[model samples]
Target: MAAAWHRLWPVLALGTALLLAGCDEIGLKSSLSPQPRPASLRVVPPTPVAPSAQSLDLARYYHKVQNDLLTRGLLRTDGGGPDTPYSADDLARNFEKIVFYNEYSSGDGLSPAQRLQSGQLSRWSGPVRIGTEFGASVPPDQRSRDQAQIDHYAGRLARITGHAIAPVRNGANFHVLVVGEDDRDFLRRRLQQVIPGIGPAELDLFSNLPRSYYCLVIAVSGAHNPNDYTRAVALIRTEHPDLVRLSCVHEELAQGLGLSNDSPYARPSIFNDDDEFALLTSHDELLLKMLYDPRLKQGMTADQARPLTTAIARELMGQQPQDPI
Candidate 1:
């Protein structure tokens, strides 16, 4: 029994040594292996830049001017005001405004600032023909309405002035274009082809025109006579609000016929920039009559035309005129 016990003791000692060796190897590998940490969830913000002082001041000035125009009844949000009727006395008062304001030419590299301030009347010396061209994108209904309005206004103008104003499909010196704002690029290209010596400034004006300018009329004076308009271009926005489109149609077309500039003093008329009186009023009709009167010839200066204008206004009002000084 003593011999068997000594043999078993040797085996037990060897097994204990093997188990301890395996434990040490496992402990070394666990200590040496890498452990990954959870990634950090953080965010960083951008630094803000300050606006230029000039830009801030300009923004203020721009808003201030618009507000002033609003206060003076010169600019209206309701697309001008209702055409409140005015008496004959008001027509006399507005007559001078019409004659002087429409007497200046603004084409062929001539700026509005460069126009003659003399009381000369500017008008078409020759017969007037209006031709309308519509953008391909303009809706058919809109095109039809625009044409009807053009024809209607042309007749009205002719009757008022007793002038040979007619609507022609071809060879018209007065071109009326109806286009959407999105089609301005196409209009620019077409204009370059149609108008002789179309300048970059004109194209730029059309391309960069403010959205507020729903319509505009550009007239070119005759080369021989600065006061005689030889060509006129009228543009009307096709995709505007109904009243705005119609108002533009009335204003731009009439303006093309020589009552060009806007007069804040001219009440009950579409010739004022105030957007008051969307349609051509009776007062405007009388002014047109006065403009095309035989006595008031084209190219008469503002100073030369006032007396005659006053005379015409008095006659229209059925009032006796004072003798000219």
Candidate 2:
């Protein structure tokens, strides 16, 4: 009996040891055991890139322009400085009553009153025409393609802003010429002949006439015969003081016709928070930044952002009594 008991104890002890090993493998442990080391989690931060020098220059230019305008009383400030950021709602609200006209044909011709009021057209006259001079050195195909892009943007501007943009033809009401070349020196020399201070870096020229029509000329500083190519426009508004006061292409088109230049903000519904997001993110830079923001990941789509932004701009601008110039 003593020999049998001794043999049974060895077998029982072996079974207990096997069971304990199995429990450790399955992560089962008594409170008396030491805690296992936790798995380390790694998180990555976003990379930062500095803006280009040209972009910084542009920002400075915009700041200076705003300051100058404010000093001249051309822009109003409600306690905020001229550099105050504006929301899409502000723009929309300010210019809600403004009207926009597109050059679309209706079944009926102009009425008698409409015909008489033609001269009173304050903003735009007709379709916009853009002329390109390919210069002797440039390939005709490239020139044509560039002109096509300009035409496309013109049409887009008209359609989006509901403004009348004249087509490019010999008798077009307004003409904008874009000249391009690969050589900067040649382009500068050509533009300098027309406007003494013209430089290679400054390629865009704008002129607003008394008839409420604006003419834009863009010189491509990089092509062959850059001078002759750049001076495609024979009549330049060299002496107009207001030529320098025109806003950017988009802003000019909107303000020229007395409409709000707020971006198109579209959303399914206008909830208060959505409205706030739209207004705060109207600026192009801010909008671009918010595109990748994690907070907005579940908030809105890119398409939805524009409409919301526009509504906010309108709200911020609201209506103000304009003193006639």
Candidate 3:
């Protein structure tokens, strides 16, 4: 019995050692091995993804609210223009782009979107008068050419908005100042003339403007109950290429008339920073028409105008005889 016990103890000890070795090989190899350390201390951020469906729904809801505030005029929707009409979707999308971007109320330090939703977008209750101010550096021939371009665009604007757009020598509400790229002094002087008493801080703001800023429009409205535009100014950089100059002219001039925001989503329209189109497309024409329509009045909040805007958009779409503009 003693001999058998000793023999069994050795066999049991051997089996126990074998089991322990198998467990170590199966589970402890990864723990014993050294892991590859990260190469550098830099940590990259994750890329932005598209807006989720819920996020898009929220955006659409906000857009609908803003559009409701845009509807206030009495003009009939069937009054079609020579240019083809756009779809309701296009009209609403462009309307959102126009109203939510491009602000001329920087003097008051209000965002374009804030001013728009609050019914602060400057409106021309009176005649829409335009004028051109040429810098001393501009040659006579070049001045003439610029004036011709301005006149042609002003006419197009008048035709599209069905408003009285006339070039005024004096008391012009909208002044287009054409300046050379290096004409910083001229730009400052004209800007001062338009917005007098702007402090050094404001001047500094303009002086340190981004290099990409080639042109801008500034429109002011009085403290009247309806918020009618008192004056407006457009600054164009003539040193840019002709196409760029033309594009600036188109965008700045149109933006001065209340659609003061640039939209990333706005395609086939000059009212975008993308430089997709050099001239205003048929889509932009429809927007201008909607803006000047008698139904939309100044001082209307987005909440107040969106319903009417929707109806007007629908009517305009219903009246379309050709393809989308």
Residue 133 displacement (Å), model 2: 4.6
Estimate the TM-score of every prediction: 0.68, 0.27, 0.64
Candidate 2, residues 18-37: lDDT per residue as tens digits? Answer: 11000000000111111222
All candidates in order of TM-score, best leading: 1, 3, 2
Quantify how close model 3 is to the true structure by its C-alpha RMSD in Å: 29.3
Better of 1 and 2 by lDDT: 1
**TM-score-better candidate, 2 vs 3:** 3
lDDT of 3 by residue, 151-238 (tens): 8889999999998887766656687887653455666866666555434644543444333345555555544432355566666754
What is the Cα-based lDDT of residue 257 in candidate 1?
Answer: 65
Candidate 1 has an lDDT of: 0.55
All candidates' lDDT scores? Answer: 0.55, 0.26, 0.52
TM-score of 3: 0.64
Best by lDDT: 1
